[model samples]
Structure formats: C-alpha cells, structure tokens
Target: MKVSLIFPKLPETSTFIGTVKEAEKYSKDKIEFYGFPPMGILYLATYLREKNFDVSILDQFARGYSVERTLKWIKQENPDVLGFSTITTAGTGIISAEISRRVKEEINPNIKILFGNYHATFNDRRILEKYPFVDACIRGEGEKTLLEIAEKVEKDQNFEEIKGLTYRDNGRIVRNDDRPRIENMDTLPFPDRNLLGNVEYKNTVEGLELSVGKFTSAASSRGCAFQCSFCSSSMFWGKWRPRSPENIIDELSILEDQGFNNLLWVDDNFTISKKRLLKLSDLIRKEKFDFNWMAEGRVTQSSKELLNAMKQMGCKILSFGVESGSQRLLEWYNKKITLNQVYDAVKNSKKVGIDMILANFIVGAPIETREEIIETLNFSLKLDIDFPQFHILGIIPGNWIWDQMVKEKKINPDDCWEVGTAVLPIPLSEIMERIRQTHIKFMKRPSYISRQIAKTLKSRYRQKAVLQNIKNIERWDIWNSWKPFWG
Candidate 1:
C-alpha cells in the first residue's frame, strides 16, 4: 500500500512581517534552499520504507504551495492513506483540520486521513469528534504506531490493538490506551533524506541564522529531563534519552558528507548529559569532522569545561532557557535553577569564545508583577547575550499551567486548543509594548549596535531581517493594539 505525508507550510518567521523577502527567496531558491525538514514525518517515512512500503512525502510548507495547489497535488498522488503532522500553534490545528476536510470532501473521501504531532496527540478525541474528515490520530511518537496502523489498514484489520491511537468506531470516537515512549532511539533509522528532496536548511540560534552554507538539524537525544511548568516537551517525549556518542557521531559524519556544514541539535536540552557531551566533543575532534553546530541548553546544565570543549568542536552558539531572573518567579515556573547558575553559565559561555549566546525569557507569566518583568529585562541586558527572545507566557497544552487552567474553568479542555497561543496572562498589547521597551533599552545601545553591524557584515541575510525586526516593532505596537478588531 502506498502512503503519503503532508506538512502545511509555516508562516514567514512568524513575527516581524508576514511576507517572504522576494529577493532573498529567489537567491536562496537558486541554490535549492529551504527551512528545516520535518524530522517527525521523515522518521516515519524512513521506518515505513524500510518495511517495503511505498511512501512519499509532500512538504507543502517548504514548497510554498497554497491549499488549492496542495490539494491538487495530493489528488495526483492518490495514495491509499494520507497523513498530516502539526504542532500546537495559534491556528495550526484548525488549519490541519480544514486541509483534512478538503482532502476528504474534495479529493477522495475513501482515502484514510491520519494526524500526528503534539497538537493531534493532545486533542485526538476532540479532533475525531469535531472533524469527520480526520479518520485517526497517532498520539505522541508516530514511527512504530503509524507503521502498525498502516499494516492493519492494508489488511483491512481492526485498529483496536494499536496503542497511542484515537479513532472512530462506527460513528463514535474511541480513545485507545497510551503507547509507551520509544526507549531505544538508536534503533530508529536515519530520517529519509530522499523523501525530503533537496530542501536546504540553516542552523541558527533563536531567529539568527548563523550558517553561510547548507545546514541541517540532528537529535542527539529525545525529551527534556526537567519538567518546567510552562513547557510541554517532557509530556511528549516522556523521559530523557540520549543516543550514545558513537551513534551521534555517525549521524554527524553522514550529515557532513551530505554537504551539511552546520548542524543544530534539536534536543530539548542538548547539555543534559555532561558526560555524553564531553565524549561527543572528543569524538568529533578525533574524527576531524569540520562542521559548525548549536544546541538548546539549560542554564544550570553547563560548565566551563563543557563549554570550552563545545567551542573547540565548532559550536558557535548555545541557547539557554532563562525564563526569569526573579528567584520567586523561577521557583513558580519550576525551572529548578538559581539566578547565580544562569549568570555563571552566561559568563562561562562567553569566556569559552562561543560566537553567540541566546537567552530565552518569558514575560507576563500568570500573576507576574511589573517589577518582576522589569527585573527579567534588566537581567537579560546585564547578561549581554548575543540574542534574547522575550516570549509572553501562555498556557501550553499538556503543561501544569494548562491543567490548572482547565481545573479552574478558565479554559475548556475540549474546546481550547488555541489557548496556548491565546489568553496571555497580560494583554497582548501590554506584553508587546513591554517587550518593545525592553528590546529598545537593551538592543539600541552603542555596543549592541556595533555587534549587530559586525554580524551583518558577516551575514548578508541578517542585515535585512534584523533591521526590519527593529523597525517593525513600532508598527506591531499599533497592530497588536488593534488585534481584537481583526479577530
């Protein structure tokens, strides 16, 4: 049986402006460039192809296909089963449902429509009940469960035995028992690069794209060891599981040979295993693999030794989860790190000569005072990181805050899939204004201006996007204030 997978295209950067830079797109397209590949679906495609299934991938997002064009292409493929993967963002789930509806109603109603990813996993039952088009959802990880579902569908057998699934029985929605998280990540095959076509990606920290040439992402591990209250990464990936240094090095070598000179380790926290990281660093140096890389890390999980080793191995950037500077707020967020730890990590990372350091801070958390928000801003500036991303705290699904909101009747569990993107503790206009002020106060300094100018001299793409982000902040102030009108 043939299988088809589709990924809806993401918005252009999701912040500064909605339009893609025509000149940049043209220049990049000449070299077969695009954003990061959807590793989730690519992994499933790999597993299915290994089992002798005819699988094809339609990356509508990377291809920049409109809904009509995507539908037309899907119809041409006309596979027995079609699947969609999505994350829980503002309008992503609703968009996925609409696409599923179009394929079912317009393309071929007989085709089985499957959904996967974070949004689908948490709202499986709700999706099945609300949308008649979505036949089933593979909750959590999809590799093994999706393969099992395909085998059953090919043979016209019952889907009841498949765990981590939510589907319809007759006319009613049925939720199955949870599936165990995949413990042996190394057992999984490398994601299907052939299915991904010639899409190019770049490794970057936060919104800053660092690599000048072709770049790609890797997962040295799965899941986050820390259960921060605002994040749902732990809920999805379950426990933390890091691949052996040997396995990780093998993938890096393959990517290096594949023309990927820069790499981004997309693990929840790349520095979770200090021992493993040091070993990986040593191996990378020993192998003489010439590749620049970056990874997300926690403030409490680094040392001078590790940072130096990473820099020596060509780690140009390191992003840290510095949610807040206030100790009270840190405790409330369950970040499990002291302010001292964050300060020390930043100092050590800078001392190690890492070219860039990104600090992610959350503003407008529930019950957060203005003083606390200001403290976070001041803390960020004092750290003097290369990049800082100030995000307004929203209730993320599968997180402690979301659960509390549901219990408190502030959010309807069944109908509030968009709560994560909406319902900020503070008004969005206020949040944006504070963020604008914070950015202006920290980023508009002479020193900061010099640093950005130097960076722009190095990266031509950064010149436009970075300046645009600063210029457009004022326009967003007016736009955000009028958000309700647009809604």
Candidate 2:
C-alpha cells in the first residue's frame, strides 16, 4: 500500500524565536536558516519502507510546502492511506484536520486518514468526535500497529479488528486494547535517510559541523528516566529503555559514512546509565570516526571522568537542563539534583574543554512566587555557562502536574490551550511580566554582554552576516508576540 506521512509547521511565536536564537548564539559557527525537521514522520516512513510499503515523508516546515502542494501531491501519488503524528497541545491535529478536509473536498473523498502520537493517544474520542473524516487513531508506538493497519487497508479488511486503535463505528467511537511496547530496540530498522533527499539540514549556527555535513537531525537512545512533572516523554515511552551502545555506534558509523559530521543525540537522558555511556565513549574513540556529536545530559551525570571520555569521543557541547536555581522550586518539581551538582557539572565540563549551554529558569509553574522567581534569576547569574535559555513554562498535556491541577481545581479542565496564565493562583499578566523581566535581566548580565562584545570583535565578518540575515527577517517584539498557551 502506498502511504504518506505529514508533519506540520509551527506557528510564529516569540518563545519559539527566542529558543532558536539562544541555540544559534551558543554555537561556534555562523547560523544558517532552516526549520525543524519532523523526525517522527521520518521514523514512521522508515518503518513502513522497511516493511516494503511504498512510503514518503512530507515536512511542510522545511520544504515550505503548502496545502495546495500537499493536495497536488496527494492527487499525483494517490496514496491509499495518510498518517499524521502530533504532540500534546501542539495544534497539529487542528492543522491536519484542515488539510484533510480540503483533501476530501478537492482531491479524493475516499482517502483514509490516521492520527497518532501523544495527543491522539490521550484524546482520541475528542478528536474523532470533532473530525469525522479521520478514519482511525493509533495509540502509543505506531511501528507495528501502522503496518497492521496498512495490511488491513490493502486487503480491504475490517479495521476494527486491529489492536491499539480507535475508530468510529455506527456514529460511536470504539477503542481497542493497548498494544505491548517493543522490548528489543534492535528489531527496528535504521531510519530511512533516503526519504530526506538532498535537503540541507543546518541549524541557525554555521560553524558547527554535523556528521552528515548536509542535514542536521537527531537519533535518540532511551527516553527520559526522571519525571519532572512538566515533561511528556514519560507519557509516551514510559520511563527509559537504554539502547545498546553497539547499536548507537553502528548508527553513528553509518551516518558518518553518509557524510554526516555533526550528530545531535536527542535523548532526554543520554547519560543515565554510566556503564553504557562509558562503554559508548570507548567504542567511539576506538572507531576513530571523524564525527562530532552533542547531547543533552543532566547536571548530576557530568562526572569528571565521564566528561573527559565524552570530549575524547568528539563531544563538543553538553546541554544541561538546570531548570531552576531555587532549591525550593527544584524540590517542589521533583528534580532530584541539587544546586551543587549544577556547579560541579559546569566546572567538570569546562575542565574537559567542552562548551556548556545551561537550560535554565523555566518560569510560571504552580506554587512559584515573585520572590522565588528572583531567587532563580540570581542563581542563573552566578552560574558559569556559555549561554543560558530562559523560557516560561509550558504546561503540556498528560503531565502529572496537569492532572494535579485538574484535581485541585487550579485551572478549568477544558481550558488547556491558554498559555499566558499560570494554572495556579497567580494572575496571567503578572506571570508574563515576571518572565519578561527575568529574560531581560539575563540578557543584560555582565557575562552575556561581554560574550556578545567578544563575539562581535572576534568574528566581525560572521557577525555582520548574522546581523544582515536578522535584519532581512521580521523581528517580533519580545513581549508583544508572546503566547501563554498553545493556540
């Protein structure tokens, strides 16, 4: 069966721009223009193609592919099925529904559509009720279930018999029992890089080289181990399942041969297993592949020995999630690491000559006070890191905190899309203003200002290029373009 998977583009928001800018500023290279690739779609495409299903991936974000283009492709390819993947409160479903509606009206009325991922897993009934055109929603990991669904469509068989699926039957929604999660990580085929074509995947920064040399994307090992109450990885992958170091090295070697120089490991907790990490580092060193990779690690994970080994394995940067400095808030959020670990990690990373970017001070959580917010700001200023990102906390769905807020009557259960107001007692405007002030203060820090000046002096040519690129794009006022919730 021929299948097409679609990943939607993000709406313009200051928080998104601010996040991108922070990522760009920290890198040693000049920033290039590229949008985030839909890795999930690529993963699905890879899985389907491995099963001998004719599959294609469409990343509207990077391709600048419009609805008209999508319709044209649908009409041209005439795929038997369409699949969409989305995150909780990401608004992908709304966009997908719009496109599906248009496709039915203009292209093909009988084409089957399926939705999957975190959002659909949680809100299948609501989605099916809202969009009657949607044929089915696959829950949890979609690799096996999608293949089964494709077979059913190919044979014109009954879809209701498929497990781990939700579909409409006689004006009523029917949900099947959950499917078992895949235990053996090695069973799945490697991602289909062929689907990406010749797309140049560069980040906002230019100097940083990826292993692929052309496109920059990530391949993850395990999901997050810790439950920070605000994250959604737990909802999807359930805790963690660390992939074998050999498997990772093999993938790295393959991509390295494919001209990939810089690889980004997207695991939320890449360093949870010290033994596995050390082994992986040793393997990479032994292989002697000419590739540089970056990954996200916890503050507690950055031991002196581990940092040294990682640096030897071409680890250029270690992005630490120093969520907040205030001990009270950190404990309240169940982030087990202490403030001392944050300092030690930074010191160890620098000692190993690895650059560090501190992901710090996410504001607007429940129980957060103005004084507590100031304490966080003060803590961030004291940290010795190359770059720090300050963002307002986004209360995504399927989080423990979201459930707690619902039970405590802190926020209306139905008003999940609002962004600005704290679900807790604080007023929305006050929360927004506090976040804005914190961001401004961090930007004005002596270290940040000095670094900016040094960057301007050291790389005037690159700086000019960046400034010219920035000038050409429309800049949104920081405060004016902020959205408190997913719109």
Candidate 3:
C-alpha cells in the first residue's frame, strides 16, 4: 500500500496573504528561509520504505506548498494511508485536521488519516473526538508503532493489537496500550537525508547564512534528565537516553561523507554526560574527520573540561538555556543550575574558544515581577556570549505551565488549536511590549548597531541578508526574533 506523510502548513491567517499565487510566493519566502528537514517524518519514511512499503513525505511548511498544490499532490499520489506530523504551536495541529478533511472530501474518501507526534500524543482522544476525519493517532516513539500501522493498513486489518495506537472501532474510539520507550537507540537507522531531495538547507542567522555550509540537525540524546517544569520535553520524550559514542561517531562519519559539514544537535541537552563528550571527541579526532557542529548545553553540565572536550570535537556553537537570571525564578523553573553556574558555563565556553555562545532567556512568566523581567534583560547584557535570545514563555500541552494553567482553568485542555497560556498569564500586549522593549534595550544601542555594522562589513553573506531585510525593516516583528533583534 502507498503511504504518504505530510507536514501541513501553518493555518491560513488573513486568507493566506491575498491571491493564491501571491500567497504561494509569500509562503515560499517563509518556508525557504529557516528550519531543517522534518527528521521525524524522515525516520518514519525510511522505516516504512525498508519494510517494502512505498512511502513519501510532503513537507508543506518547509516546501511552501499551498493548500491547492498540497491537495493536487495528494490526489496525484493517492496513497492508501495518509499520516500527518502535527505540532500544537500556532494552530498547526488544527490545520492538519482541516487538510485531512479536504483530502477526504475532495480527493480520496477511503484513505486512512493518521495524526502523530507531540500534539497527537498528548491529545489523541481530543483530536479523534473533535475531528472525526483523523482515523488514528500513533502515540510516542512512532517507528515501531508506524510499522505496525502500515502492516495493518496493507492487510486491511483492524488496529486491535497494535501498541501505541489510538484508533476508531465501528464509530467507537479504541486506544491500545502505550508503547515502551526504545532503550537501545543504536538499533534505529540514521535519518534518511536523501529523501529531502536537493533542498539546499543552510544554517542561517536573521536570514543570513551562519557559516555558508550544508546544515542539518541531529539528536544524540532523547529528553532531559532535569525536568524543568516549564518544559514539555521530558513529558513527550519520557526519559533521557543517550546513544553510545560509537553510534554517534558512526552517524557523524556518515554525515561527513554525505557533504553535510555544519550541524546542530537538536537534543534537549547534549552535554548531559561529560564522559560522553570526552569519548565522542576522541572518536572524531581518531577518525580525523573535519566537521563543525553546534549543540545545546545545560549550565550545570557545562564544566570547563566538558567545554574543552566539545571544542576538540569541533563544536563551533554552544547554546545554554539560562531561562532567567533571578535565582528565585530559576528555583521555580527547576533549572537546577545557579546564577554562578550560568556565569561559569559562559566563562568556560569562551575560555575554550568555542566560536559562538548563545544564551536564551524567557521573560514574562505569570508571577514574574517587573523587576525580575528587567533582571533577565540586564543579565543578557552582562553575558559575554555572542548573542542572547529573549522570548516570552509559551505554554504547550506537555509543559508544567500548561498543566498548571489547566488546573487553574486559565486554559482548556481540549482547546487544541491555541497554545496554552501560563497559570497567571501576563497579558499578551504587555508580554509583547516587554519582549520588544528588551530587544530595543539590547540591540538598538548606538554602540551595538555600529559594532554589528562593522561585523556585517566583514562578511558579504551578512550584507546580502541585511539587504533582504530592508523590505521589512519597518516591522516590529523583526526585533522580536533573536538574530534580527540585535541586527
């Protein structure tokens, strides 16, 4: 049976920016600019293809395929089963349902529609109940579950015994037992990059290429050891499972040969184990492979030794989730790292000569006082890192804040379309203003502007990226983004 997985576009806002052709052009600009491939879909596609099923991927968001074009592609492919990778952010999950409805109404009515990944995993029943079009939701660690599903679909068998499956049975909902997490991650095949088919992915900063190389993302570890309450990762991924150094190097070696030199480790915490990095460094050095990559680090885990090892492993950039500078807020968030540790981590990364250090700070928590908000902004200025990304804390399905908000009746759990607000959400306008003011305070300085201008003069790619921004330079939205905020 033919299987097609689609990563649906973000829901149309304002009728998708005018005429369909203009909208398509606008979408192409949005899609072609940022984000790497949808690795989850790539893994699923690879697994299905290996099982001798004809599987294809339609990354509508990444490729900028409009609703019309997407439906056209769907009609042409006419797969027996259609799966959608949906996320809760920005009503993308709801859009998947809308697309599924179109597919059933306009294209093939008999195709089995499935929703998987973060949103569906948490709201499986809600999705099925609210949208009757979605046939099933394959919950958590989808590789094995999806394989079982493909087999079931091929044979026209019901999803009775499949683990990690939530499907309808004769107009009644039936959710199977949850699937256990995969312990030995090494057994899983590397993500199939060839399926991307000449997308020319690049690592970009404010639409500027960061280093001008082939860029992709990988995850060496799943989940975070420390479940910071505001995070949804631990809830979604279950636990921290690090792949062996051998497995990681094996993937790296393959990635190098595939002509992808620049990479970003999409792991929640790549430096969870210092030993892992030391060993991986040795392996990369032993292999004599030349590849530069970036990864996220926890301040508590970012020892000088670890930073040094990461430098040896060709880590060009290190990002730390320094959510807030206030120790009180840090404790509430369960970051486990102290203000001093944040300092030490940034110090060590710089001392180790890691090219770029990015620190992320969240402003406008529900209980966050005006003083605390300013403290975070000031703290960003104090850091000697390459950049500081300040964002308003967002509420999603699996996060602690979301649950608290739900408990407090601040948001409805069944409201799958909207990102949940914090327990005591700071008003949207106030939060946006605070974030805007933070950017203005950080980036609009005459010194900072002149410094960035000097840096821009040194790189032609950055100059081009800056030129591209001239059209939208009047936008307040630009300042809201980390890279463009400073620029």
Instruction: State the C-alpha lDDT per candidate.
Output: 0.77, 0.70, 0.77
* 1-487: candidate 1 lDDT, tens digit per residue: 8899987665443332122223254464432323566788888998999999999997766666678888888888888889988766644566677788988888889888898888788878777888888899889988889899889989998789999999988888888899998888789888857687745554333333455556777788888888999888898889898789998888887787878777777889988888988998899999998877778888777899988888878887789999997999999899999999999998899777776789999888766877888788888888868878777786757788888777878777666574354445657787777777776677668988897677667744455446655654432233443343233
| Each model's Cα RMSD | 4.8, 5.6, 4.4
Across 304-402, the per-residue lDDT of candidate 2 in tens digits comes to 898888878877556888888788888878889899999999888877867434455676677888777667767777776755656567665677777
Candidate 1's displacement at residue 449, Å, is 4.0
Q: Evaluated with TM-score, which candidate comes out highest?
A: 1
RMSD of 2: 5.6
Stretches of candidate 2 exceeding 4 Å from the true structure: 12-33, 205-215, 417-487
Kindly provide the TM-score of model 2 when superposed on the true structure, using C-alpha atoms. Answer: 0.85
| Sort order, lDDT high to low | 3, 1, 2
lDDT of 3 by residue, 339-439 (tens): 99899999998788776678999877777887888788788877776677766676778778777767877777755334444443456666566666766
- In Å, residue 271's CA in model 2 sits off its true spot by 0.9
What are the models' TM-scores?
0.89, 0.85, 0.88
lDDT of 2: 0.70
Which ranking of candidates, highest TM-score first? 1, 3, 2
Could you say which candidate leads in lDDT? 3
Least accurate stretch of 10 residues (summed lDDT) in model 1?
A: 14-23
